[model samples]
Target: MARPLKDPTGAELARLNLNVQARFKAAAKAKAQTHGMTLTDYLEGLIAADISDLQAATGIQEALIPKSA
Candidate 1:
């Protein structure tokens, strides 16, 4: 027999209201289902990726700026 999966601990819950076209919503749901992840997990992954990209861009921009003595 296999052990059961453990639930995540200390996770915070958030509520969001999005207004989108029906087709768009359906497409997103289908994509999430294909990846075998809940919609929440898929969205969280996207948000994390965006944050990382933004941080990298910011670091590059800061490095390009000249420093004054």
Candidate 2:
């Protein structure tokens, strides 16, 4: 038997407005549905991925900078 999902506790919420076209919004919802994820999950994953990529790039850039004695 599959286990039931646990409810999240003490999670904070934030709200933002997306000025995207209706078609883009629909497409994103459809993509998320196809992957069995809610729209929120899909967006969160995208944001997390972008943060990771930016961090990696920053690390590389820092490494290339010369340190002054």
Q: What is the C-alpha lDDT of each candidate?
A: 0.49, 0.51
Off by over 4 Å in 2: 1-11, 53-69
Q: After superposition, how far is residue 29 of candidate 2 from its true place, in Å?
A: 0.4
Q: Residue 13 in candidate 2 has what lDDT?
A: 47
What lDDT would candidate 1 get against the real structure? 0.49
Question: On residues 1-69, what C-alpha lDDT tens digit does candidate 2 reach at each position?
Answer: 111132133335456668889998899988766656556556654664567663354332232222220
TM-score of each: 0.55, 0.56
Scored by TM-score, the top model is: 2
lDDT of 1 at 4: 14
